[model samples]
Target: MSTSPTDSVLEGVLADLAAEGDLLETLVADLPEAGWRTPTPAAGWDVATQIAHLAWTDEAAVAAATDKTTWDALVTELIGTGEQGVDLAALAGGAVAPVDLLSRWRTARTDLAAALRAHPPGAKLSWFGPPMSATSMATARFMETWAHGLDVHAALGVEPEPTDRIRHVAHLGVRTRDFAFAVHGLDRPTEEFRVSLTAPSGDLWAWGPEDAAQTVTGAAYDFCLLVTQRIHRLDTSLVATGRDATTWLGIAQCFAGPPGEGRERR
Candidate 1:
């Protein structure tokens, strides 16, 4: 049987998600034990804490798909709504040894992939924000993994090798434009803004009307880094044409929660 378009999209994002996770693992897997304690860009979160958070979130995604009771309890406890920050300390999973933590993350990510695959077709999974379909959930997971992985990379003094997989992150950055505005108590642009990102493979990935007055254009990798708050907007080559679009470049965020102060200007 031929793969349906929907099936292909799901498979594509899930595969990209797995690859992103593997990349992070490859960077950190053989690190010295003391390296796990290295501080990252995120305040108060060490390298181990960053990985632990990713693993905890993967497990949470699995619970959201497979166990309503656990999911609800987790959302109420660890997943905060706007105004409050996530209690990362609560989701630490108590893995003290570096090996134990790495093993936990591996198991959690594997379980998350299985849970997403088994999710009912055409059904939505409840999240901190609006409900998400299986594909959307996978994309969000990939977005988070890449964002957090940057933190680990920075702590380890390694430059990330950008890939086409970040198209997922760039897509998420575009899709969440409205949410980015909403979270910041600003009005969302009434008309869709044209977004043209140059992908790593030299292909232009774009959205919205081609001739839209308000537009954002930049390297897909830089845009992803901006939206994830990994890089300060001032440091990017991104160009914005209109008022709303210009404001977005300053505040864009693909992940959940209120807007962060963002990285220091460079």
Candidate 2:
């Protein structure tokens, strides 16, 4: 059968997810025992906790995609619990051994990718923010894995090689501009802002209206780092040319939840 538009979108997302997953797995594959205990950029979270959090979120994603009852139960439990935030949930993984954490993360991530692929193309899965199609959900998973992977690599004092996969992250960042504003209790920008980035392959990746007065131009990797809250806006090479764009760069966040404490410029 010929591929549908939704299938094509999901296929691309799944490929990105695989690339991101492999990058993280390779980075942590040979980590020393002490390295697992090393504190990452995320306050109080060690490398082990980072991987465990990925595993936990991956498992949650699978449930959200495949089983509404299970996903709803999880949502209810999280809501009922007074301390159901990202940091708190991630830190809970500190109790797991490093070996077990890695194993669990590997299994859950693999399962998550499979579950996403199996989900109907047009069906929406409930998420922390809003319902999303399988393609968008996979993209979110890739973004999270990449962001956490950066934290792990940073703690180990290693820089991950840049890849075109970051295009997915950059796209998500631009798409979430409104959601970021809403999360911060601010009004969304009335006008569209152009976002243009130079990808690792030296191709131009862009979004929003081409002739929009507001624009953000920069390296794709830096843009991804900015949106993921891995680096502060002032620290990157990104140039925001309008008030809205500038303000967006200051508080851009790809993940769901309250604003995060971004990294300080070195």
Candidate 3:
């Protein structure tokens, strides 16, 4: 049997997820007991909290993919507790021991990958924002893993090797341009803006009209970092031309939420 286009996309996303998960695991595997409690770049979150949050989210993703009832209940509980913001989830996970939390994260991530693969490619899964296809959900999981991994790595004072996997995140950032604007009570850009990025392997990846009046041009890794709010826009090499592109860069966010208070410039 030939692989369908959707199958191919899902496979690619799964591969990316595996790579991201491995990176995260390898980065924090050797942390000392003190290191687990060390503060990360995300305010009020420690290394243990970061991994716990990932574990929690992976379990949630599995529920979203495989069991709507459970997923809906989880969402209701989260909302009912008034637990808003990403940090709350991380904080909630802080009680687990480091070893137990790491093990749980590994299992949850594996289960999430399996669950996502089993989901129908075209079916929409519920999320914090609009429903997402399995591919988009997988990609979102990859992005979250990468972003949180960055925080973990930062807390440890280490840098992760950039990979082409960030292309998925960069694409999500571009696609969410209009959504970001809308979430902030601003109108979407009337005209499309060109987005050109140089991938980690020196290959150019792009989106939108090549001749569009507005343009965002930069390294793919930097672009991903910007959209994930892992770095301040001013700290990146990204250059945005035209008013719309510039504005979008300032407010760009890939995750669903109210507008984030992005990182301040170093």
Give the number of the best model, judged by lDDT. 3
For model 2, residues 1-266, the per-residue Cα lDDT tens digits are 89998898888988888888988888887877888889998888899888888988998999998888998888887887634555577777756677777788889888987898788768899898889998899999999989999998899999888899888899899999998899888999999899989999999998888999999998999999999999878789999998988899999998887788889987
Q: Looking at model 3, which ten-residue stretch has the lowest summed lDDT?
A: 80-89
For model 2, the local distance difference test gives 0.87
Off by over 4 Å in 3: 82-86
Cα TM-score of candidate 1: 0.95
TM-score: which candidate is best?
A: 3
Any idea what lDDT model 3 has?
0.89
Per-structure clash totals for the candidates: 0, 0, 0
lDDT of 1 by residue, 66-109 (tens): 99999988777754542333544423543388899899999998
The deviation in Å at residue 80 for candidate 2 is 2.6
A best-first ranking of the candidates according to their TM-score comes to: 3, 2, 1
- Cα RMSD of all models vs. native, in order, equals 1.9, 1.4, 1.3
TM-scores, one per candidate: 0.95, 0.95, 0.96
lDDT of 3 by residue, 147-241 (tens): 98998888998968898999999999999999889988899999999999999999999899889999999899999999999889989999999
After superposition, candidate 1 runs with Cα above 4 Å error: 79-85
Steric clash pairs (candidate 2): none
